[model samples]
Target: MALTGPNGPVMTREEVDRTLTRLGAERDAVEASLLALQDHPGRRLLEGAELSGRTRERWSEAEPGLGLLWSMFDTYSEALAAARAVRSRRARPGQSELYEMTELLRGRGVTVSAGQLPQGGLHITGSTRMSEQVSLTELVERMNTWYGRIIEVASAADAVWTALPARIDLLSAELGRVRALARSVGVHPGEHPAGDALEEMAKELAALRGEVVADPLAFWVPRPGAGTGAPGGSGSAPGTVDTGRYDRAARTVDGLRVQLEDLLRLRDDADERLEGIGETLARADATLAEARRARGEVLAKIASTEVPAVPGPASAMRERLAQADQLRRHGQWHRLGPLLDTLEGAAQRELQRARESLTSVTAPLAIRAELRGRLDAYKAMAARLGVSEDPELIERYDQARRMLWSAPCDLRAAEYAVMRYQQTLRPTAGPGRNSV
Candidate 1:
């Protein structure tokens, strides 16, 4: 409540009261902080864990520093209590009481026992086994330093465990579903590349999860430097988990899922295509039989002509179709896909060839029919022109008619006689009545 020169103040009722109140508040806050640090989950885990690597080595040093921190706090508490007792004996403190309170609050009045501070990387200065005295202010500062380091190690290990292991478990569950689907679609290990890859990925994920559970600290990534004070005043900076391993595993599983889906689609398409191919091949066989019958008719009814022989069913294509069916039954869709494509095309081509052959086989009969129709048309023209009894015209028409009507007839001779009949009748009909 009153301002004084540095180290010039003396006894005053108000100043001493305010100082005690301030010291009491500081003590309560310090005690609460110490309890919180002691009870922290990360701290408890670190204490019980069988840590290794950098974490294990650093924690070994911080462990003794932690003991020293508590020991120093105890001494500070005792010194504060003793100073309060001295002041409480009177309503207003004497000069000696005031001087003691100032010394306790601002001077070196607390002692820490020897062998409490480890020598690896603490900021304390004293002989290895010598006791040292410090002011309450300095003691609090030293405790904060130790608390920060210990929390730094503990928080990093905790953070890594929190981030990675559970995600790995979820991915592993999804991986199981993918494996089942793959097997259903005939994508078994050693039979398909995708299946083999899936198996390898599953093993890697299992090992990664085990390593993380055994030593989470190995995956920890600390901040820039030691003792840089933790973010948000939690006495330790937050750290990152090594997610590269987990991410790679997730990506592999995703790829396998895509491959399995594609295989399933191919299976459906192959089944549909194989059914269609069977129908096409059957149609081709029927058409070839029809073509063979037409060839016999053409040979009997028309002479001086040759018909091309009809093709038989495509043996190679049917053989491939059989192989594809075998693959489908054995759940070997990968081999069946390409073979089905080839069979479908061959079947279609075979059907087309049969139709073309039928057309060729009946060509001679078609010619004979055309010649008969022409000969009859010319006779009607001759009658219309009053030359139906013309001697030469009548003889030519009769000859062409006999050639077209008789079996094993020569189509070439019939066509020639029909043309000659038209020429002779054209003159008898005169210019206006010429044959069309």
Candidate 2:
């Protein structure tokens, strides 16, 4: 039954008991939520971290809000305890006890100090210099607001710490292995371009990891479309850490690793190819020496033709080959590989030149031998025609033979004389023997 008293329909005992029971449950829930917030890992991390930038400024304001939260919770707890104590004194609360319970539940029984409701940009409306009184329900609403703000800050920071540092560590470990492999293959700073790049990446990664550890919030990536203002500003959403820099570093290191592998393969190819080129160069020198000796012999035995001098060995190419060997010994494969290619091409060209020279130097000797063979063939043809005893033919044959067989013979003059003898014999030998 509802009683109509001066204060508008006072609640009956049954309604009073129900209201108290509900309030008690609400109080228990609020207290549990507060305790959980206190023990939250994010909250602990925020408390211990060396924060900076907007996070530092905002935490300074939020810190006071945290104190107010506990203070308000304590007041709410005491008020609930008093109400419960009063109700438990009797199986049914007396009129005075009921009046006290109503006031505790709905009236302004919770008091907060000035600036403690919400300060430092929190926007809680109260006199800054005077204390304020609020109902238990209003106080709980205020506590919820404070709790939400503080939790946002803590959780955002903790999320960045959890995600970025470990990923950086794993990437750094992979880079270390790449550096070791690079060293094994003679890819080092100042010696190879890719090795130098890898060294730079290592330094960047080291600095990035250190910065992340010291101030994770600095690396936090706010949610897209979130507010551009400070952390506690309106419409701001929480976000995770940014791993873009680390990802780029990882890709760069991987690219360098591939380049180093190619260089290592080139090193092996160059070693084999350089050895072959050295053999080719040695053969070319020998051929050139042989050509020079043959030139000397042709000048003495075959006259009236100037043989071109055989070219000397290519000393410049030999010098380059020696430089390549030095580079290979010092593990400068990046330089050695290209140098070897150039030397191999030069060596092959030199060998070809030497062979052509040898052929050129022996040309005159070949001509003199051809003349002697022509003279002998005409003599044989004359004997077959039964003109071997002809005095004119014998005189011509002996003249050509003396010129062909003698040293320093003028091959041009001897060739002319042999052609005259052949002309003289061709008509006598008849048209059927034109070739002989």
Clashing pairs in 2: none
Pairing residues by index, what is the TM-score of model 1?
A: 0.66
Encode model 2's per-residue lDDT on 313-387: one tens digit a residue: 998888888888888888787777678778878888999999999999999988888888989988998998877
Candidate 1, 12-35: lDDT as tens digits? 657667767876787777677667
Give TM per candidate: 0.66, 0.61
Q: Alpha carbon lDDT of residue 356, candidate 1?
A: 88
Q: In model 2, how large is the Cα lDDT of residue 291?
A: 99
